[model samples]
Target: MSNEPDRAWWKEASVYQVYPRSFNDSDGDGIGDLQGIRNRVDYFDELGVDVVWLCPVYDSPNVDMGYDIRDYRSVMDEMGTMGDWEGLLDDVHDRGMKLVMDLVVNHTSDEHEWFQQSRDPDGEKDDWYIWREGDPDEPPNNWISLFGGPAWTYDEGREAWYLHLFDEKQPDLNWENPDVREAIYDMMNFWLEKGIDGFRMDAISCISKPHGLPDADTGEDWFDMDLYFNGPRIHEFMQEMAAETYENYDVMLIGETPGADPEEAKKYYDDGVDMVVHFDHMDVTYGPGGKWSPDYVGMETLASAGDDALDEMLNTMDLADLQEAIRYWDEGVGDEWNCLYMGSHDQTRAVSRFGDAHDYHRESATLVATFLLTQRATPFLYQGDEIGMTNADWDREDIRDVEARGQVDILMEEHDVPYETIAPFVRNRSRDNARTPMQWDDSEHAGFTDGDPWIQVNDDYERINAERAMADPDSIFHYYRRLLDLRSESEVLVYGDTEYVLPDETYPNVWAHRRTLGDEAVLVVLNWQDEPRDVSGVEGVESPVLFGNYEQRDGTTLQPYEARICDLG
Candidate 1:
């Protein structure tokens, strides 16, 4: 057994996300499994991530990775067996770490026994899933799926259209039924009884859809979500779920609701839920409008959201100013508007999305690491992010995300358009790029497993594997390790209050900030430019540099992608 503390130990520790498909694969059956994770337990223990937020590992049809659960009680056969999961859990506890699994109860697989029976023409479980009728002459409802299509899918055999907020394969559950809500809560107890420490709820608020099945030309872009996302009974259900598991066990629970209102979010935390993700975060680049502009926001739009809104946003941010708030999600959110960022099964890889290979990938990775590890909430580290992994090059033919691939096919076949025409847009939209295999060591399949992986590893894995990064002190791995150590040991960075220092008003690329505990403040600066610039922010520049990416001196010039941190009274 490892000498780590007990699972309760994570309150003071950091988490590392492990997306099964991309995490190391022990058996190499084209997917990552429990044994694959177990094989690297020692590495995790060494890196010192207190919790492992495993992406969905349940039995599923792989429609939305594991977000579309078929059997809440078991692991997918492709990933491993129930026994394998048990063993992995034991290993985690032995190392004094906790494991957080994805709780995808908002929807279930089309093949799930419940859904199958519900859709059966003459079955016992009818009405378990939301089944509706098509429009008199057009479609079912005006609601659009997150994957970009009608939320209702007609089942020919059943003569009814089932509701799916995501892929057609995932049918949303009807939480209005007492038995349904009870059963959902029962699943929480089931996992808790198994000694599971926590859950990352998937689309938990979508448990109930709009009461009335209103059709489109109805004027509203999305009638379902606006009407039901943080539904009337969502808080009630959350309270029941929390009372059953979270409140008593010191469990961490986070729900995934895209448009959840802040006031509504406070309900989850207030009802004894551990945390709720701050989704409005990704919306602040231009503020009010939520556009993703690389160039810093102009004063006009930035001012529109008001200084108060921006102040609260910057203060509650899970990462660096705007970018960290938008990027670096492995450090996910919790109750009380705490942010969660581990790339659950659905999101793209942090490295590829935020780090560019030709650009300051390593520097930016380190800067990002420093930013997230020392933030206000509990930070989560995604599986391969310790080594700064990048996304694999994608092709439409190589795409595997069900919704993305299906959409591409529909567009191509229906419109007779070239795949190349929408390839770039599709590439940005595909989830498969984030689902590739973990890059472990330089070997076949990057030492993930003996067999093929579910997704291909980034082609450059040969040079950017765990073994290589770990060997270099200046590497992303070492930098992350240092951050973990500092955050674990220092109160100022770990438990201190955060304040944002504006950029050198004149310079567009220089980002700076500070974290203060009592009178002591720690300043972090990043110069995202090719030519060196003046370090004019933060009045006092301590004599001895605390930590810097590039060498620093009085009136030091910052190089492109350079970052520096200073401690002051």
Candidate 2:
């Protein structure tokens, strides 16, 4: 028998996520299409990414920005036709890169044919969605929607209330129905036959619900997610889907599981998915009020505050908590895999969230890139993060995300909070931050569109853009390129065991770890603060610095937001 352990291509490959609507608008329609993405395949090749996870481009009203999918096989008219999508696939494959489409199977747009049929009282597809009959004055249960309303929406036609965990435009599919599972499996097979490499399963864990749709025991008004998130039948559904589709093809499966822990994730891995994206590490800095409250401090505050101010902020920060979360997965997952990322379509920009987006933009951006790339898990680079994109400076009127607008309405109507009080928090944590147009150049609309862009381009595009970064050898773009190259070439980085040299609690601002594969080992040291700090607790100090943000390093200290990778072999 061969002694070598089995490995998959996705385990070692790096993925780049492209939010389709904001990537580029080639037709001057202010909306990015498949042709626009096809035009940018060369950029992906140059960046050295192995896979591109394209966000949803399916036919929809865009109520949740394409998450409310109207059709499974058809492309959106604004995005392009099936022909254009095929051409984009060819272009991606031609460049030696693979493309992964977003698989949104948890819910379907209310306008979807299946949903419309299911809404009919005597239709054959009546059981295709979750429906219950109850008093019109009150919902079936006390469950609240994720978008800040009642989860159940009454359908006058069927005289029933349909469950919608998200927007009312999106009705949750009844996975318990064998016919629904078969239909979803057929859709997956259709795409797999279309030549795409894999799928980035969106909200995969939310497919299952508790045995009884009971009211949650919570002190707050909002429904507790524990009743539905990763509930009773998650593993069964995933296993069935995997056995019917993913297992038959040589494709990657990445599940976006928000509430899944290391143990729960291992179950999914055993069922069939290749990797899971957990969100515990990302929630460290969230205050007691969660993501919507104004009590949490923003990244801009951390970057500009003084030592005393920073100390107070550090108390509220979750550096140690984040480190523990990563370590737990690294140890608990065993041979299974996990995905590493600093930002995504649903979150703020990585550079603006974890790195300094102000004076030390370049250094801090590169530091975060290096930290993520050197980890043992597969790293995903969000769109424009390679060029150090910052969050959009959007005003109240500029915001277009449905979730944000709903939250604002809830705060005003229910809590009696003034609009001004919550506007700052909305700006700091809105999904719109990562939904702005890509800054390709310093053109009228940052070279993203020839005509009017859908969202306003960042004003700093003149100083921070792909054109300038590609021209400069020391830019964040080139740093990311080099980091990807290093990961591709280093076996230790791809499959090594990670060991923390300085735990987060001991030195909260400094994240230091060592990755070891047999006799070969590499040390990664990153300073999360804005001030210089002495590096300690690491045994091997005489190793050569393989990569660093600063040109000159004293070997014993790291400059503000400095990142260093040293080969200890």
Candidate 3:
């Protein structure tokens, strides 16, 4: 609603997302905690990030790896006590950085006190969750949970069924209940009053559901996401929430919207959140079957792979579609805001997913960093991404993510999918890929923990650890540092209008874009191939190189996986 220029710290700041369980294990319990994060505040300071977003550390059963909240006010026992979290916040502030907590309000763990009381038919919190009287053998609707089975679970105690959009252990709360909304709002205020900066709202758009809970039109047994995502009262609830909490404090609010397009995202901003982390751009490589059937370079292609096949894999990504999505959000939101990120706790490693992580690791890593950092939106760097970390080579036995494991079971049981048929996709697209312990050094357990890591560390830690990166001037860590510095120093990079130069179909291996603010502009050219390519846009122009991955480059020729930023003043 406000088309004014954004001067807020969040708009200009770079966010570093740290998954606590995998970040670093300070207490050596094989799990990263608040103390671990506090111990590494200097690393964030050195990276020059303005904010650190810690994923859910709230009390949970770890059924869904912290997404299922048991207690909103208390920290997880494995993560540390509330005092440890407070100490971490103080350390981040002392290092001149802000900390944002992941707010998971979509559902609560079944073990939560509210849900426990709701289980009692005559209890005070009986209506706190969505409960319906239905046949004990049948669910109220044909809706399926996001994790895999029937959405409604029949509770023998109450002789009714409760709706759970995710895992059965995580029950969806009834937002229609005024007391529930008030409780959530009070929780928000509690964290705000505790000196935390803001919240990265988890699955926020899916909080509201249709009035009658009607069956989806998709004909499939599973609930259609469209039926519930950004429901009728979504904006009303968001506005009410903002009026109650966000409006009263100077803080940032970023909602994680799975199916939100630019227009829907604009609505979220209008309702008072700063921005929404939309997934359109990240899903460019998804095949017809979605994440389970991602279109990746085949083994045969890799065996006989030339520069062309490599280019085809990297360049064929619907970059043009990604650009359109970015432009749509920028134009649709006016001055609200948008988040630019290539990876997160739920997705695969960015360098491994988008860039050539094997052969041209450093070049591809910096290339992706350069492209993301120069964008108009606030850039988010996932932990371990700064040092070019890749996905862990895990077998089926090593899988830890509930969604991944559940999907595997569903595929095998329902779809007749063989282990070999689904394992490859799971290996490439599993959230566990990003959940591996942070590779801090080349020492045992990647220096993440003294004890055995909860998950296997990537074997390439010797070459990709942060310790080596910090010591090497030409490392990805330093490149990220320089990119962050550019954003800090140049106002154009922070608030510039984007202009895509080369279309994806025309120049499949090249992505060229210009960011301009008045007369000042920055041109970013990325060659996503494994072989040299000719760059043709800035011919005969006199623009000094602002940043580049490779050391030497002729004005027109680009090396393999090369990335360059030129100041077109």
Candidate 4:
């Protein structure tokens, strides 16, 4: 009898994340709606993606861009009605693709009915949110919000303080309250019953809070993550939630865990999450002081900030750090599954961040695609990434992301930091870089809308739109489609065990790895930098080149930003 682990659909699936506001604008209102998604259903099919992970389109105040949910069951008016969402779900299903909704139950908009009712201190829903009694001037604790300012907000009507880990308008739910958990489960079931595939739970690790909600013991500059993250009853809450909702249906549950390491990530699987979106690889460049620190932007001090700071950068995503993180999770998960990604709605463009966008745009983007698809995990391709989208060139006045604005506000208000000093770093690392409208064509507004767009389209749309890419066989879009097709046909690539080769110290700019399944092995060689490298010394480097980004095959030297998948039988 075979001892191989049981096969699951999610383990073998590849996901495509769609940011609704920027995916496609159908109403010409400049914002993408459900109908717009329905219009592009054929695109998902053409790309051969197995799952479409839709970002939150629920009723929201647009604070934090729909992360703060006002109504769980109602679809936002701008995104269209419930009928539009149902049509989208059906369209996706008809194409043999699954649809996963973004679950943002960690917090709700202050305008939520539950929060509104909770304001009446004597009401039954008073404890629905994390409310505490304290002096008006001083909060119950000294916890700092992840966005900016104190974590607590004064509620004049209730004469109490409420906790908001993100924007002040987004109040954290009291998961400790059984009633709150029940309500969330009911909401999940409602969506599941409607035939949706699964959920991508947002800020899921922050669902449970530590007892007493203590203040920070570690200095003043901190989000107090240690106090609130991976809380005491996190496992219990997750297990309960799963048993009550997802376990009843054939659905997958993926969690967004920010600070979790490999061992910590394993617990989520036990807590009923099929897999977790780990930050090990993503947060590699974030300094010890966190994302906004000067070290993250390659600056030792803001005093030396100048117009050429970006060109004189010292810090960037380290290959060694990325390798270590990827290898750790790849091995740490054991027989369990993993979610592989290099870009997301909250991150900068993959080609710009990890590849040489200015020098080897096509080579680097296709190389990055090769890296993700050839891994031993279910890969998630972010919207526009397949078309080799680059980050936006936003100036200080063009910044639209709330996270960037909040960080800027904090730095200026508390530390008296000048806007000019932080503008370059913000422009490079802002989430808005990934939120730009999808470039469908080279027409006006890049064919995204007839009216004004919600966010500015990347200025390079004329050269990098999908229409141009599809017409070219050698474009990044076609490369992605080929990789997806190859991945679907090869079980070895999906179920193979990974082995890292060429130690980071010896080959710092090259990523050489082997995926082996029984006697079949595929060697994936990636030249991560924009310079030719001698890869002849690597094991199995002479094997048959099953696939590669370059037209000419070099047995000894790998071209700049080149990638190859070699079959070694």
Question: Candidates' TM-scores?
Answer: 0.86, 0.95, 0.94, 0.96
What would the per-residue lDDT of candidate 3 be over residues 1-569, giving only the tens digit for each residue? 22234577888999999999999899888999889988899999999999999999999999999999999999999999999999999999888899999999989999999999999989999999999997899788878887777889988888899999899999999999989999999999999999999999999988898989987776632458787588888889999999989797888799998778877888888888888998877777675456653235554453455543443353346667767766777776766788889899998988888887778889999999988898878899999889999876667889998889988887667646466655555656789989998999989989999998888888888878999999999899999998899899888888877777854565777788887787787888888878988766543223788888888887688889888888888
Residues 1-569 of candidate 2 have per-residue lDDT tens digits of 12243577998899999999999888999988889998988999999999999999999989999999999899999899999999989998988889999999999999999999998868999999999998888898888888878889999988999999999999999999999999999999999999899999998999998887888776763567688689899999999998899898889899988778888888988888899988877777567677775445544453455643442343345567778888888887887888999989988888777777776899989998988998879999999999999876567788888889988787666656566545555655789988889999998889999988887788888888899999999999999999899899988888888888764456778888998887888889888888988765566644898888989887677899998998899
Give the Cα lDDT of each candidate. Answer: 0.67, 0.85, 0.84, 0.87
lDDT of 1: 0.67
For candidate 1, write residues 1-569 as lDDT tens digits: 11232222444668787877668776657777788888888888888788888888899877777777889888888788999899999999999888888888888889888898888857767888888766534556567776767788888878888888788888888777777777878888888888988887777777755557565442524234565477667778777767766677877776666656655666766777565665544333223322212113333333355533432332222233564553233222222335545343455555444434445678767766765665656777777778877655567667878867766776566546576644543433356766677788899888877886666677888888998998888889888787788777766665555665545356566666666776666877766544577765445444345676555444556666677777775
- Quick one: ranking by TM-score, best first? 4, 2, 3, 1
The TM-score obtained by model 3 is 0.94
User: In terms of lDDT, which candidate is stronger, 2 or 3?
Assistant: 2
Best by TM-score: 4
Candidate 1: deviation at residue 258, Å?
1.5
Q: Which residue ranges in model 3 land beyond 4 Å of their true spot?
A: 1-5, 219-223, 294-316, 414-417, 537-542
